[model samples]
Target chain A: MRRLLPALIALALLTGLSLLVGATNLFDSPLDRSMVLAVSRLPRTMAAILAGAGLALAGVVIQQTMRNRLVEPGLTGTPEAAMIGLLGVTLLAPGAALLTKMSVAALSALLGTAGFFALSTRVPRRDPMLLPLVGLIYGGILGAAALFIAWSTDLVQFVGIWQTGDFSGVLRGRYELLWLIAALAGLLWLFTDRLTILGLGEDRARALGLNVRQTVLAGLTIVAIAVAVVVVTVGAMPFVGLVVPNIVSRLWGDNLRDNLGLVAVMGGGFVLASDVIGRLVRWPYEIPAATIFAIGGAAIFLWLLNHPKAHAHG
Target chain B: MIDIDHLTLERDGRVILDDISLRLPRGGITAIIGPNGAGKSTLLHCLAGLLAPRSGRVRVLGRDIHHIPARERARLLALLTQSPGTVPRLSVRDLVAFGRWPHHRGRPGPTDHALVAQALERFALTPLAARDVETLSGGQKQRAFVAMAYAQSTPWMLLDEPLSALDPKYIRDIMDRLRDLAPPRHGLTEAPAASRSVLLVLHDLQIAWRYADWFVCLKDGKLLAHGPRDTTVTADLLSALYDTPLRLERVSDSSVILPA
Candidate 1:
């Protein structure tokens, strides 16, 4: 509880700031302010928190399942694959429901993540950086494919919307799908022990009577759903997953059952804080939380690379 | 008892273990010893049901190992492989707790917690229970891994080269623990009454000769010899197994092997 106090406080403060700092002043007109709060400000804050928490939880699962800390859903071609699925559905039915698009996106994300996992097995583990580098390139390739498809279909502008993660477009109904991440978080709690066992490597996990393949598939599915819902709702929020889980693991430890709630809280807090900063930095205008987090996340990642206690593979 | 019948494993056209047959008796320490690349680890893996033999089957206590569910197999036997991978930032107690996974399947009962505590105490790891596994010395890490295997509470424990890079003190410490856990003595205060049967792939012939009651010697993936250690582990058999002359010297009621 003591460890969580700061994060909870931060969350509360940022949520308040998020509600008050928007273009329509909260105190300017009582009815208008309440309307804005109910419709736009509240949904935006919830979106930021849910997306952040979901991505961070997904990041932990990917890191644990792959036995490497550097990898996350965004780096593993998940968002790109999800984008590709969205693009395909848009082209095919043109009027597909949001749920339909999300399902397709989740499916493709799972396949792409599974492909990356398959590729990861062949890459030698002598150097840890090699896997993440491979994932980055894999994500790049998938992104290129999505861009190519978007160009041909004349949906490049739509693709651009998803390429930047902004909560400005999030309204009440538009962002509820991200609640699936909350469900995913619950699933993660249920499977926390199995996921931790996976970090021990295949032989150990199998020796412990865990169905290694089944556990991995379940973890990847959760990651896919989380990434896909976030992308479908608020675009791609890069680095939240990677950065939040690393921070929590460094502060606490890798015992997922114990650290998961803290990881989610930190992740939600980080994104909410980022969104608040993005809102205030431009004043009446806004900056995408993705851009701000990418800048900060990259710096921390570099420091993590050079830290003496970092794993040799890094 | 564990039984292997005509078990053969071939990988990538290279025979790892060819036409091997053996029966490992229950309730004692059985050592698998051989030259490098003699399939000592491979045979151990086959016995543990980690590797599937190309032709034959392994049976543990009248049940075919591979045919049973994986959780059931884990309950029957525990295997500690060479250079076991570590989960970063994991505490010693948490790693040891994983051994009870097969028994409780994630919802660990009080009995599981009590057994983990006992295993920690038995391995002298109680002091380091809260320490990260990565921070431990190599010997301590090895002991933690062994403690995890012990915590599994299986009747059979199969270890592969668990003493490859340990100091004399650690080596002796682990051997003594294994010896005590074998027949005629229960493993720990919290453990069930059944004595554990330990099978390890060992290169240190001295430790094997000191602690192991039964021997399974292999050469070129074939069963060279196996039986009660005193009777079958003669100087000539040892010499032929290594293709080099090795004499057994009786020193103060315990024997040591030296190059002849």
Candidate 2:
């Protein structure tokens, strides 16, 4: 509880900042301010927070499930698989309901993540870096295929927005799907110990009376839903999951049940702060949160690689 | 006691354990000794109910091990695999406390907490209970894992090379702790009243000979010999088992196996 205080305070500050700093001036009239706050600012801030928390939770789940520290939903072909599903829906039904598209994307992302899990088993454990590299390559292949389809179908513009995470377009009705992450986070909380047992690998988990296959599928299902929902709502946030979980694990240990709340809070803070910064970087004009996070997250990733604390692979 | 009836296992169309049949008496430490690829670890896995053989059955304490549900089976047997993969950055107490998982599922009760504390105390890990498992030395890490298996409070412990990389001090520390936990055996027929029966795969023949009350030797996936240490283990059998000359010699009232 003591550890959570500072984080909660910082997140509260970020949430307020996210609501205040935006393209529109909220001070013109009380009615306009309230209208803008309710319709645009509130929804965008909530979207960033929800999407961040969901991605971080997904990141930790996949990392523990695969027993690799450097992996997350973005690298595991999840977003690309989700993009393909979205494209397929766009091509087939052209006007399919958003819910239908989301379900399809989530299912496709599950299959894609399952493919990475299969490939992960064949990867030798001699190097911890190898699995993430493999995930990168696997995601690259899926992404390349998605890009080709998008180009051929003349849906390149649609694909571009989904590929980069931005919150400028978020409104009350559009980003409601991201609330699925909150439900998924609650679901993840129930499976906390099982997910931690997963880090022990197959033999140990089974020895502990855990159904390893079922638990893994459950975990990956959560990851797929969370990732797909975020992609569909605000586009892909690359390193929110990757960086938040790693930082939380470094400060606190890997006891998923105990540290989950902190991870979610910190994750929300990380992305919301990035979004707030994106709004203010060039006063009136805006930058995508994904671009800011990519620059910051890449630097942190490099630092984590060189740090001795990151030697959990051994 | 473990009963193996015509057990055979094949991997990738190649037989790993071919028609192996043996009964390992319960109540004491039984070391499965063999050369590399002799399927010692594989047989241990079968005994722990983690692996199912192709042909036959394994019965532990009168129940078909393979048929038992995983949760019930966990209450009966605990297994510590060799190099249990990546150690999560969990505290030592938390890792050991996972032994009570089968009982509490996820919500650990007071009994679970008490047992975990007892396990920590018994393993001399109370001082390091709050430390992260990944920060421990190789031997300390091994002890923490053993403490976890111990905390499971099962009737049987099937360990695969629990002492693989430990130095002599840690090996002796672990062996001594295990010796204290196993029921005292007077003869092969004496059944243990309540204590755990340990079955381990050992690469160190000296440690095995020092601590194990029974021996199960395998060569090329076949049982070479199995009985009390004094009756079943012979210099000639040890030599044939490893395809190298070995001698059993006594020095200062203790028996030792050395390459000859």
Candidate 3:
């Protein structure tokens, strides 16, 4: 009961802010005020919520499976790898459907994450701290691969696909597919306890009757798909995954099930807030979601360095 | 029963365990003791299926430990490694509840809750049920971890240096609890139609002498001696295992002292 009040207040504030942002307009729409509401504000807000929730949920699960506090979808290179896939398809096919593009991105993301897991497990790399370091390196490698391909093909526009995260481009037709990804994130919530057990370390997980390898693989797979869709739909929101889940954990507890639900809401709130700030900071001109998140996230990371939340939440 | 046949473990260029063959009958506390680098923990890890031996086989209950499905293997055995980092927000009950991961896979049912509650109570952690594990003292965290492994409800429990940093009282308490659980009394010794055995990598020779029913001693990555504690507790063998002169003397009615 004591904890309930604060959470409710936070929720209400987020919802109110989201609505307020939904009402703000960039264009004096030739179509009218109602058109802007139905078209731009509504769908973009929904996509931001869905993408935010999905990425944050993925971060929570990945953190659990990897048993590390610093890990996030972007750090592990899944989103970067997915962007590479999207860049390839967007440049080459030029006519690929959203689903086809998502599939390609998902596959690439899985491969990237699996590669990270494989290297960590097989190479006597016991430093859990180094896991994220390795991930950053892996992501760098993939990011470079993508840039090289895009540069060679002269698809400079495609190269910017993952450079920033922006919900402004999310229209109803293209953004609705993210709901499928979000739904899958919801489904993964069913096994939150399993991911929590995996966090206890692999041997304990196995002893408790969890398929440790499978749980980890499955968890990573979910993160891959969620991040792939997030990348394809909304571009790469770097620390949104890292920040929202970490905050949710500090506020709540380590029960992944509870954290998953809370993070989805919190993540949506955080991204929506940033999106709104982007609108206001330079109204009508608008800012990229990733850029806003980058500035906000770096501040949060610096704050976390001073008052560590990973230890608090993890 | 835990059986290792011709097990060979290697790291870098050095062999850790060379053709080591052993069987731990279910249902007693077995201590694996050795000097600084005798591969005690290595053997324990191989037996737990956390590490696959370079060659040979480890069969826990007539099933290849590594080959067995991970979830089923977890249901059968639990491993407690040296002082793993704590999850900051996890309460004692929540920590213990993780033992049921293999059983519940996250959708913890009523039985899982009951088991967690029981484990917390058994370990005298009911009071700290809501306190974060990270805030607990070293001894308290060890107790929490042990309770978690117990909550796993597996027939076999493998611990590496569980007694490190614990005071004598906590050590005795833990040993007494495990002794009570070791077969013919509690259900811990009921594995693979045989005695339920607890294999531990121990640094304190006295603890090994006082509590361990069986011993597996290693030296220079080789099996030096193994048997019932009484048979293998000689000072000469102990000294050889450590590459130094060692002595085991009765210090008190309830304690044995080994000169470090």
Candidate 4:
């Protein structure tokens, strides 16, 4: 709770800044502010916050279920797979509504994630660390396939396209789908301890009358949907999941119920900070949210790796 | 009562347990002792319904354990395998509290907390209950796991090498706890209230001989001996079980098999 105060205060300041400043000078008057705030900043910040919270929560679930600390939705190819699905929907169903596209992307991401888990289990070696390695290799393979598809198509430039998640285009209709992340996060919070128990190891769970495989499938499903939702709405933003959960766990230790709540709040704060930084770093020449996050996240990950106290759980 | 008739377990086309038949009395600790790779663990898995026999059946209290609903079966018996995966950050109290999950699902009530408290005190984990299980010493961690199993309050506890890594003190502590445990809500007519039955895959012959009321021995996936310890745990049988000459020493409660 003490540590949470600082984070909460930081979140308020950064999120407000993220909402006020955009492509140009900040408006001071209430009447002057409502239009800019409503049009661009609100949608963008909301998108960023929802994506951040959802991805981080998904990361915590994946890492726990696999019993591997380094594992995340990004590491396991859920985001990449969802990106591919989003691209496909944009191409094949270009006439479809955004809602339909998001749903298609989510479903494809779910299948792809299940495929990754299935292929990983069949690799003759089920070492926990092998999960991320296998997932990376597996994602690389699917990425190549996605690349091949892109090359064969005339829509290659538009194939892996994204809106920059800056919410420059978001209105009432565009940003509404982003609110689904809150619902997903709520469901996860309700079942947090159950997932933790499932992750402790299957034999113990089985002895306690948990349907081990069912619980695992449920966890994987949650991760899949969360990744897909973020990817469809915001494009490929890696490491939000990895970064948020790792930071929260270190600060609070690993009590799932509490850690999950912290992950959502910190996740929202992280994306907001990144978005604000992205807006300021280039000023008029705005930086993309994904690129800004990539640089910052990579630095944090490198620092984590070099830290002597850090064990292999980033 | 567990009645097993012609039970066989095969893995990857290799027999791990062959045509074994036995009727275990409802209320006695039955030790499954054998040399390494003698299907001791496999038999325990089959009994716990975690694995199915290729060709036979295991009836626990007249119910086919393997075919029963997993949750119901878990309520009846608990299986603790060796080297159960470590949960990096859960506390002793939370881990043990999981044992009550079968009864309560995710909604642990006051009874669950009460049971966890009782289990913590019973296992002397009150001080360590709130600490991360990963931070515990080996013996403490083993005791924590045993306490979790005990918290299950099942009629039969099937443990696979529960004493492998512990020092002598942990081994004795765990053994004494097992001996003194009472299977919850089970008031047997013949087996006294404080007596719990355990089916353990034990390597240390002395501990088995001293603590177990009955014995079963296996060699190369086949049953070699079963029944009263005095008759089955003979010096000749012990030597044959390990393929070496062995000597026996009579202790106060039982005897020890030592290699020659």
Number of the top DockQ candidate:
2
What candidate 4 gets wrong by more than 4 Å, as runs, is: A1-9, A28-31, A123-128, A162-171, A302-314, B182-189
Residue B91 deviation, candidate 1, in Å? Answer: 1.1
Best by lDDT: 2
- Provide the overall lDDT of each model, using Cα atoms, as 2-decimal numbers: 0.87, 0.90, 0.78, 0.77
- In the predicted model 1, the residue pairs found to clash are none
Question: Which prediction has the highest TM-score against the true structure?
Answer: 2
Per-residue lDDT over B160-201 for candidate 1, one digit per residue giving the tens place of the 0 to 100 score: 999998999999999888888885322312233477888899
Better of 1 and 3 by TM-score: 1
TM-score of each: 0.95, 0.97, 0.88, 0.92
The sequence of per-residue lDDT tens digits that candidate 1 reaches over residues A89-179 is 9999889999999999999999999999999999898788899999999999999999999999899998898888889898988999989
Candidate 4 at A299: error in angstroms?
Answer: 3.3
Writing each residue's lDDT as its tens digit, candidate 4 over A1-314 gives 55667777888887778877777565545456676677667788888888888888888888777667777887776766776787687678889987888888788778888887777656543465777788888777776666666777765654355423444455555777778889988888777877777667766667667777887788888888877777666666777878878776654567675567778888888877887887787776677777787788879777765663422111
Per-prediction DockQ scores? 0.45, 0.61, 0.47, 0.48
Model 3 lDDT per residue over B15-82, tens place:
99998988777778889998888898888878877887899999987889988877787778888987
- Which model, 2 or 3, shows the larger lDDT? 2
Interface C-alpha root-mean-square deviation, candidates in order: 5.7, 4.8, 4.0, 5.3
Per-model tally of clashing residue pairs: 0, 0, 15, 0
| Model 2, residue pairs in steric clash | none
